[model samples]
Target: MNAAYAQSSVTLYGVIDPDIVFVNNAQTGRSGGQLTGKQQYSMLDGTTSAYFGSRFGFRGVEDLGGGMSAIFTLENGFNAANGTLGQGGLLFGRQAFVGLSSASTGRVTLGRQYSSLWDFVSPLAIITQWAGYIGSHPDDLDNIGGTNRENSSVKYTTPVWNGVSADAMYSMGGVSGNFAQNQVWSVGVGYTGGPVRLGVAFVDAFDPNISMFGATATAGGVTTNNLGSLGSATTAQRNPVIAGYASAHRQQIFGAGGSYAIGHATLGVVYTNTRFVGLGGNSGPNPFGYSGSSTITNVEANVGYQVAPAVTLGAAYTFTKDDGPNNQGARYQQVTAGAHYLLSKRTDIYMVAAYQRASGTNSLGQAAVASVAGLTPSARNQQVVDTIGIAHRF
Candidate 1:
């Protein structure tokens, strides 16, 4: 490992990922009007972190000898397509933290960072790693996509032992009076052995209305979708897949995933359970009429193959089920395919496609329609999306 950094090391790193995408169906309607089942064909990218966030960062390490060291990282998320800051325009929206490490012990860090849950399950999930947020579960309700980071947090990671390691984290809500108002806690563990990797993770958030949806208790909740309105395709940001579920007062998630490598091929699968608690209160002005709580289960299976030294191919399938009030549930199914070609060690290009269909009552008790993880929810029950992009890291 380079003999404990013979010299102090500071490095600059970042990724620029931009894509042009098209959608078959993009939902739109007048405010509080009716649903206008519409189809959209336009150029789209992660203007709102749609997938594989584009970011840049600076990190450094100072070796103290005796198997000890100090480290720090400052990263920023941005819109590579338009040269703008992301993550609510924070200077270091992606991450900002410092910590100490001991070769024989572990590491302890403080600042803004991704939850332990993310460190665990992301590697085994297709959307989180390759497809980016576009493949996230409905609404990214599972955090397999949006807001994957936390602020005012402390984290710990145990030294790897026999290919096994564990991590835990806690985020202080920063509320003066209500200490627990927006607090969050997470834990994860993983094992990486030859040709195989396995992991499981969990997270709980208090006062999810603001923590997840970026709204206050009074102003929290999703806006009412048009009942039956339609619109012509334009350059409008699509709605979240499960917008109505935003009213959830609290959020909880549990997930497990694993990958196995076989020769030139790797196979993986992941399962996640996400829930929104006490929706009645946080539901925005036009709540989804859901009382009590709601739950969603997502299951995915995928395969990756190295067709050549610098070329790869992948395919995947996902199944989602929503358990809403009174046992009225909805169902969604999706198929995905992609191709990636490496231009160099730090640069590559890709093309991806996904199709989805939905049925049953949605989060707001309306007819369910297809919604891809990254694109807008569809007015009808089916939607398709395709994108071509290039990513460069330095």
Candidate 2:
């Protein structure tokens, strides 16, 4: 072993985000006619985690000499509010990866990692950079496909050149006999100069089975299928008749953003568009089809000003629209204002408020229920939320 190789360091990092929230006309349970049997409910709801759905991670690099280095990271997400693992009870839910890199050839890493869509588009939006609920496009369609993350992935990121860079990732199914099920791939490119940035990305998932409200047949007879029982079956068995719906699942996203400084204030703007096709499944006597092409467009603008050396004030507005086959469509608009006070470089206190309104038809043409998967509602049958919180990173 070389003397230089023995000198290596590992670091720990995490963030805490907790907040108080209020929702108007909230439904207690899942959709469908049996919705808690209650008309509406309202209460003080915690928006973020109590402490922070915080994450702890370890990262290290070893010098192999000759300009070569080996690196790895293991990150876990925990609910600071209740001290439980996040991401549906998966350990190291945030990320886990190992890789090798060189000054000459960029880096190649293998493990669970963020897709290129989020890496390229998230930073461009003020809502995403500040408020989690507000920053994401309806359901995070522009960020990483609505709460879905790639697993068993191999990624490559090229070093920056002339303010431009690129990345590609492929997720493996890891199914022994069947190879193509639950696989995903993505590619993206970005450029940044001054205060302007632009990005483009594409994502494709093959036979990525998803669960929906439907029925399944068993030896006993027909039964209402829920997520629990559906998880026990294979992709082929879960929605056998609609298997074609899962084939060639794809999404494409493109965005542009920029900021300009003026005196003590900076103004920013961002725009994004996303397209989805061939998703959802239903196979039975009562078949409900959710597969179709859809388009989502989002636009946002904001201004930030330094109130004092330690205090910053910001305000932003966002608009989103979704158009789908048939009459399934939705529109959302939001306004947000907040202030941050820096107690130290790594610690801060902040307060923010956002108001959102949505209108449209749900998948089933239910007038009261607006079909927007994630966003603020306009009425009781719609979705609306107001949140205030604080975050600290270390």
Candidate 3:
């Protein structure tokens, strides 16, 4: 087999990240906004990117005459510590696509893929990009870190032209006779000139509630007073804040980010607005207990420095606000810091920490708990986490 593959070049690559983590005020339940009063210590598994979720993929490229090429990639994400699948247990959870490329034009791929907005703008997110997912805005609610992946999707990415590039993507909902149901569409544009780069992206997703809740329902006469009679299944969510709005008919996000490099330091800022529409209707609880439309706005800024040849440091802060019906809303303030030490080109060690505070009520009128992206909700209104991990690329 080794000799048989001599003429072909295929590479396998991935990153494995694991961390020892400590959390203060971790939520004990899956949903319902209940919190624990004690601090918790544990490990960050393959489900999260404490340093980075472990992943490996195979990729191949073949020249196809003048300025063209054939390419394919099959990637999977997993928990580095437990050796389990990530991204909801899909086999090729991270990515799987095949396409042709042209130097003069662009590339097109069809498969499950990230939205254009996420692909183009995620790297500019100072918190998620450098400080880790624990630094992400509340719940990673806007997906500014590209947490949501689209299935049955097609994407096109244009070649850079005068430091500018563009991307577009559409995902099929796969619901017969309902083309837009659970569908996702996005577009992004970026400009990179010297040390300064900027990106703007927009994303629209239909039937967000159905996608998040894993079912479709018609709210017949669910109201506030009898909400407790619906039982626990509908309110079973990973995050209470997001669960509250799981009844939303649709979701939309607008994101913009920019970064500048000066000397050994890079400074960046990212902003996003996310809206959940058509909630608070007469919808019976299907999964989440409450139904209410809401909007989340986030702003973040960060800076990174190469303090030494093998060492780097970064810090970021994010502010988030939620506006919803019945005046049930919340605000979050988060701060994070991290340091990375390079041991080799494909290996590095890092330590990161984050702290967040929350205020006001969540979707179910429960005290808003501080929860970082990719992590569990807090039992109280504030939370802290710290991790140390190593990552390897191969």
lDDT of each: 0.74, 0.56, 0.73
**Once model 2 is optimally superposed onto the true structure by TM-score, how far is the C-alpha of residue 25 displaced, in angstroms?**
2.9
Q: Each model's TM-score, in the order given?
A: 0.88, 0.77, 0.88
Stretches of candidate 1 off by over 4 Å are 1-7, 30-33, 37-41, 46-51, 216-240, 282-289
Q: Which candidate leads in lDDT?
A: 1
Over the stretch 207-312, how does candidate 2's per-residue lDDT look in tens digits?
Answer: 4332111122211111233111132332111211122223214545566666776777878777777655554422222234556656668888888888898887
Q: How accurate is candidate 2 locally (lDDT)?
A: 0.56
The superposed Cα distance between candidate 2 and the true structure at residue 352, in angstroms, equals: 2.1
Deviation in angstroms for 65 in model 1?
4.0
Q: Over the stretch 188-234, how does candidate 1's per-residue lDDT look in tens digits?
A: 99999999999999999876656554453112123443222323323
Candidate 3 residues lying further than 4 Å off, grouped into runs, are: 1-8, 29-34, 46-51, 211-237, 280-292
**Per-prediction count of colliding residue pairs?**
11, 5, 5
Task: Summing lDDT over every window of 10 consecutive residues in candidate 3, give the lowest-scoring window.
Answer: 217-226
